[model samples]
Target: MCFLAESKINRIVFLSTVTDSFPKRHKGPSLTSPQRPTMRLASGHVAVQLHGEELTKIQKDFKGFGKGLVRLTPGGWLLPAPYTKFADKIYNTEFRASDVVIMTYPKCGTTWTQEVVWTMRNNPNFNHPKAGIPVKARSPFVDSDMLAHLGKDVLNSELLELVKDIVPHPDPDEGLALQLTANIPDPRTIKTHLPFSLMTPNLLDTAKVIYVARNPKDVVLSFHHHSRLMKSMSYVGSLDQYVDYFINDQLIYGPYWEHLREAWPRRDHPNMHFVFYEDMKADPMAELRKLNQFLGTDLTEEQLEKIAHYTSFEEMKRRDDFYREKEMQRLDQEVSKKDGGFFRKGEAGSWKGHLTDTQEAKINAWTKDNSQKLGITFRYSL
Candidate 1:
């Protein structure tokens, strides 16, 4: 769909290599039994499934992407069949300069941050219609669960629509359009669902990065709901299991405090910006103003108002792009709602009531360890 500059892409590739050892390989995908296969992608190319019947692998093509199979998620593979090599095929060949990378741990406010950055780059008007193109393709998350567990048929439809929606004209060679977008020379913002360690090699060194984080207590609740909607993660151990996972460092991008700690020092580094979800939720206009200022742009009151209101949780909930993502098809029709949403009720205190007293105490202790050392306290809790 959209593209990141070549230099940024190069950095992402380098970093991905640094972190590339393959996390714990999952048991084969769980395509049968009660759980079905959900297919995600290699930049909207590969099919990431849990165990399921071997459906005929379809040749889904994007302009510059290589032919990739729909395999499975990064950290999970319930299928008994071999998957690492298969996943490697897609990941190894696909990520290029054109993909705008949005890297963050799960539940760390990635979706919201991606939307903000995408709007900053692509939706200059701030008042443009949301119907013209699919937001995901324009700014996609490569590792999104939607791309991971949805069926191939559904994934194909979304991919087709995303392609048509973003470029309108399709090149017979899938990689052509992407290459063109990459070579076009303007900055393109692509979102990623990958953690910092899993990002492409060359992205950070050359391109700008904005990392969004939330307090771990809220992240746990947020991730819990997110896991419920994502079938692959639905059966992930137990609440207690997850809580321990959170503390002992078992969750995806675990050691939540550590990830932030590593990134905290760079909060004020010229190319990178660190944002807290609570801060934005509390004063969206102020956040937007600051973000715009970072990008070397200023907004008229009307423009600022447009951006702020449109991205507001209340407003984003009504938009199809924000709520009904075509890619997140594996989520249960009923339970997904219970987990809140892409734009869950945006408040800092949601954790106050939900997080157990023990959990709160642990988070307090965790924050104390580095909140001041890493400048996290100054990063904005909103």
Candidate 2:
């Protein structure tokens, strides 16, 4: 939805790769009840149903998600079925004063920003052995119950080994990522797609939170590709079908407008920092500098330059393994290999290549209708 001249921008770099899979396949029956139950949302979207190949595929691929979706009452936020069990556990997570968290809706530069923030804060030298570890290990995604439920056969040995020594939780439904996030060393860097409303009320008071938002037009396109790429999602729906799900808030962690609106009013909180995907792409150096200041890291210009170089889009792509979950790709070799794996275009406004004019107009109107009162203007074309 937006564009910037890559040649005109100062290059910056970082790394992250999160391909979550269970150690074994779930051969048992679906954890959810057999009957599919549906609920209507405040927006008139069906909370537990999308009624298409998309929902069918999700239900087929992720048996743990009983109905494939579950609606959070009061707010009508739809999440993967595991939320029915993991919600309280996630909400009760402990936060440290020194912790830094990267929060965003899916595919909104969460990994990109995680690498940047993690490198700047924990691996400024870029030589730490931990730097080589996948970001999934370095920065735990607290809301990963969705991925943990994928129950794929290919396990992330790196992650499994990392958490091997930790005592397993009493609840079998608790995600490994949640345990890792809770037990990681201090000054932890965490990631999540959950909105603030679903998080602990003291999150802003307990730790620094960075929220990254992107234009819905680009987010919809990126998420569509991601859904298709992820084996757990196996989305075979058309672009138009996906777009309807996005705008209607039928997708998991959706009500995109509401997600941003939840953070916009809290943008001024001392511990909250807001960033735009377009701004980060347009000038990563500028955004990185802002992050440095917000973090009070006091890193010199030289360090920022080195961090920028290490996290550049080209460098990240070159070192794709460090930023992508390669194990998950084993099942969908053709799509992952053909589409360049998790590190896709990473460009703003790439939606122009795919979205029809009608789709664009519809998304634009939806954005205008929802965001007008929020005062959070998004750049469709940077």
Top model by TM-score, which number? 2
Please state every model's RMSD to the true fold in angstroms: 10.1, 12.4
Candidate 1 per-residue lDDT, tens place, 194-267, comes to 44433444455556777787777777777776665654444334555556546654344344655665567666
Model 1 segments more than 4 A misplaced = 1-101, 126-132, 145-156, 165-186, 236-238, 321-329, 337-339, 370-375, 378-382
Off by over 4 Å in 2: 1-67, 152-158, 165-173, 322-326, 329-331
In order, candidate lDDTs are 0.50, 0.71
TM-score of 1: 0.65
User: How does model 2 fare in lDDT?
Assistant: 0.71
- Looking at model 2, which ten-residue stretch has the lowest summed lDDT? 1-10
Top lDDT model: 2
TM-score of each: 0.65, 0.81
Mind giving the per-residue lDDT tens digits that candidate 2 earns over 1-382? Answer: 1111111122211112112221122111222332334332222222232335645655654333443565543344668754544555677788999999899999899988989999888888778777876777788888886566655543344567666555254233456787888777867999999888778888999999999999998999998878777666666668897887788776778768778878989999999999999999998889989999999888888999998888888888777655455465433566677876777888998898799988988898888877887888988786
Task: Name the Cα RMSD for model 1.
Answer: 10.1
Locate the minimum summed-lDDT window of 10 residues in model 1. Answer: 57-66
